[model samples]
Target: MNAIIHILQTQSNGILEALGQHISISLISLFIAAIIAIPLAIILMTHKRIAEIILQITSILQTIPSLALLGILIPFVGIGTIPSIIALVVYAVMPIFQNTYSGLTTIDPNLEEAAEAFGLSRTKKLIKFQLPLAMPMIISGIRIAMVMIIGTATLAALIGAGGLGTYILLGIETNNNALLLIGAILSAILTLIFSALINGISKLSLKKIGILFSVVVVLFGGFAGYRSFVKPTVNVTIAGKMGSEPQILINMYKELIEQDHPNMKVSLKPNFGGTSFLYKALESGSVDIYPEFTGTVLESLVKTNKNVSHNPEKTYQVAKDLLKKQANMEYLKPMQYQNGYDLAVKRSFAKKYNLKTISDLVRVEHRLHAGFDPDFYQQSDGYPGIKKAYGLDLASVKTMEPSIRYKAIANGKVNIVDGYTTDPEIQEYDLVALKDDKNHFPPYQGAPLMTEKFAMKHPEIKTTLNKLSGKITTADMQKMNYLVTVKHEKASKVAHDYLVSKKLLK
Candidate 1:
């Protein structure tokens, strides 16, 4: 119950922000669709054959997938919210166009006769009688389009367009169930509220259904208006590791600023890269701040994860020294979580060949199937080196996304799978992970890296992020990740709830 309250308090602002973006995309597209559709409908009324052909063309456009549409548009239009608006507008055209035409055509024959008998001009009859009568139907069509777009616009986050979908996508990727559940709950609520608002508008304007819609356009003219024109405003970018865990952490940082450090301007960019790539971005200053595993930095960055001196303190020290000297980066405090690499297998397979470590696979590796993400399969620290170090020769290896590979293993398509130690599915799927007794891989401990420039601008950014370092135990992270990816929650809620539950923030 404490966890639930913490989530609502922390993520409510982000949910509102996402709602704003979702509504902006939906309303703008709907408005544009009405402009295009209404005219087309009027022309179709005048020229029936041409309208049929135009409607058929729009029908075909509606069949394409939203993701696919975004993909096609990305190469030409590039990224951000603009491309999202265009795709949604295209999607909206068919419904709005059809409804407008139907409403106009279905007007009472007697009304037309009355207009004609009154000796009104064609334009006058159309505007005074036909248009007013069609208002309710037109509004209904727009309402349907609005609802459809609200749901579909959730897809906008895929191409870096900010919306509630950002949380949803990342939650699924990392297997964080809390993140998934909270995201769903918030998105559902927003849709229902927006639907109610629009319906209220229809009732009030159309004047028959006894519904009243009072729309208040709280226009935040721009970012300048949202922000105070005071001195000492700080700009900070906090990037998370790709998927839900990172997204959640970033959102937590944002909430912290809003709650305690309103003078600071916090901008979050989640899913920067895998643990290793984020290190590169940090070193190069392309990214200002990012979350990472401590063991990962110790091994991949400092090259210090070894069979000897594998303790956490020594690992953190070695990594800290390396970052200070070579990368011009600083670590504030470690996070509560320690996400690490894990290896999984079916319960039957682990028992069958006595597979307990990297070395054990050598005995029956010939008959086993191996699976990992395609990128993980080819990395220098991946299977190639594992083969050389442990002599675990497998019969075959397959590559797939981290999401799909677990299913592959569960279905018996593969006997062995690479997994994140913090992933919840490792527990839910009841898979067994072997210990790397030989210490074949390096450690991956998480820390936030901030550029020297960013540190000067926003000191609070480092403090807020670093507060979470070393906070999440392996099991805790695994559970959070499971809720995100497997259960379909939201990342912002996951991070916020986790922090609040742990008393890191109010």
Candidate 2:
């Protein structure tokens, strides 16, 4: 009950904004689907062979996974509203097209003959006689399309498109069930409302329906004009990885930036495909800022295998300097703690093997089965490099989801798993993090990375964001992650509370 009130009271603005984007995207897709499908359906009535081919094509599109379709579209069209709408239109077309074809072909032959007896022109016959009778089936098709599109539209958030799905995804990432529930409930409500509107219009008299359609056209035109011409005063977009820590950090930036610069518009685009995705988005101008780690910038972006200085402060400076020279990117002050990747095993397993460090794991590694996230195998500082550095050979390695890795180790599904130092599950599952005795993995102090040009242009924005520097301690991050994943608190509220406690905001 408290969760419900929190969402309603605290997150109301986000809910409305997402709702508008969701409705606008779905409606535009449905409108486009109707325009294309209805005309094609009419043409196909006279050409059955062509109808079969086109129907097969659209049927295949419906079979493509929503996320996969969006991914494929991204490379060609890039991300955001355009690719999302294109994907939604592809998904929506078949239902409306199939229904239109069926409605026209299945029209009563006696009524058609009666219309022909009046010497009706072909165009007039379609508009005056055939279309009116087919309206019900077409409307039914549209209702199905609209509902389906609403659910699928949520996937658009994965590609950085704004919609209600953003809330749901963030909720899941941050372990905020209330935010998740609100996003879901609003999506369902929106779906039902759209379905009801279509049904109501279908039931209206022809003249009344025509009047309503005209009004819709005018309203849509005005909205398009507003979106194109009337821009916000300041737009700052912040993106980050898909986890509670990054979500909290980005939300903090959002709160602080908006509070400090009230006239500036701040947007959160968290849970990107990966760090690489965020990098590309930043480079291409889709985003202005994002939370990153010093070590990740050095290792992944710079592709450096050599370790930097041992001191955290010096290491941060090294990373910052490297970023400035190599990519013209700026690294702001880092958080107080390091969230470096670590290898962990269950407490019992560790005791039995007497494993206190990565080198210790090498002693009994050949007898152990290892589990790691896919990124571990792909990254330079991940499993393969770690194994090479430590000269260890495990019996087997399996790729697993990050969230399930802790349970896998605890349940003995895998004897060892890769983890982060700040992961809350480590304490919960009673696992032990193996020390990096060989110092193979570099330090990963979290910070915000942006283009130097952007920083120079918006100096105050940098100052507002840097308020988070050295603020979140290691224990603080673990506690926040635990609160979201274990306690089910909202990420936004968690961030807000933390800022208030720090007096970063009032």
Candidate 3:
């Protein structure tokens, strides 16, 4: 309880910002769904054959996984609030459509006959009688959609559309319980508030619905207008992976860029999936920049795996050349840290086995089980490559989520796990990262990746961002990660303090 209160107090501004985003997107999505579903429902009621087909289509859409829907939309619409809104609207259509059709068709046959006998026009009857009678059912559909959207909108954070989900995603990535709880509770509270409002309005007369809806439109329109008029002159968007290090780097870049150029508005896009989403977004012009590792660029993105060395400078050079030649993206200078994946074990396990390096583990390979993330397990440099390279294999292995890999090893669920050298858990759990004596992994030096077109348009951005190069050392990154992952500190605050200490920002 104290932790929750402290989070609310210290993160009041962020909570409010996320709150506004959450409400705005939810309302907009509900409004859009109503427009699409209500009219389609009315039109389809007359065409029974067509209605069945359309309803089936909408039902199928509702069944599609939310994350999968977002991924499908990202390449077409790119990231941010637009794609998020589109996905939410798709998910929200069914309830509204079904209820609207039910409400209109469920009217008594005698009422239609009486209206025709009284010579009332079709449009007039629909407006003066049918619609008013059906209003309750229509409102109920909207209520259902509003509630669902409130929850679904939380996933928007995965694609960089800010909401309370931002805290939740970041919380899970950094392992911060307080941040996770805050996001979850606030989202529930927002849903309840909107549900109550809809219920109250549903009980009122049709005239009251119109009046309340108009008020909502006016308020939202005014806020939109205010934002448009005050938009910044130069807009720079920075995207990154879901982990703590990427968050730190992107936040650091945002702070530096905004501090150096007050006229520019810098946005941080968080990608919860992986680097592929961001890479495509950058190429497709959805995002302008992101922090990438040299080895990942060369090996994973560039597919230049053979004979890669442990030298950071060589890795950076190779990655820069390949990226520039193939994708027209520029690679900035590398940071003073190597975050390559290494096999790690609890210090006690290493001591008991007398293991100090990758080669040393071969002796105990048959007796030990290993845990690794599925991504690492499947990658070329992962377990498969490791087994072939060293001619050794573990007795058993399990693929698990990256977030739990460290905990799994620490708790004796596995004897070894794949981990980044800079992971804070290494220090927290008193784990020893075995030496890579044969240079099996490429040098994973941190660097900034930006599209050449964006760089040329805003040449100053590259210069400003490159200021981060050679600044964040191994210890610096580990400590910053520890603050967020262990101490529950916000990434922006951690980045800001690091910049102040480096004399890079005021």
Q: Model 2 residue 48 lDDT?
A: 88
Candidate 3 per-residue lDDT, tens place, 34-115, comes to 9899989888877888888888999999999998888888889998889999999998999999899889998999998999
Which number leads on TM-score?
Answer: 3
- Model 3 residue runs over 4 Å out of place are 106-120, 259-263, 270-273, 305-307, 345-378, 387-401, 404-416, 434-438, 500-506
What are the lDDT scores of the predictions, listed in order? 0.69, 0.84, 0.86
The best candidate by lDDT is: 3
lDDT of 2 by residue, 253-291 (tens): 999999998888987777765666677677766678988
The positional error of residue 504 in candidate 2, measured at the CA in angstroms, is 5.6
For candidate 2, the per-residue lDDT at 68 reads 68
Backbone clashes under 3 angstroms, per model: 45, 0, 0
Candidate 1 runs further than 4 Å off: 1-159, 163-168, 174-234, 272-287, 298-309, 486-489
- What TM-score does candidate 1 reach? 0.57
Supply the TM-score for candidate 2. 0.79
**What would you estimate as the lDDT of candidate 1?**
0.69
Candidates ranked by lDDT, best first? 3, 2, 1
Q: What is the lDDT of residue 336 in candidate 1?
A: 48
lDDT of 1 at 96: 79
Candidate scoring better on TM-score of 2 and 3: 3
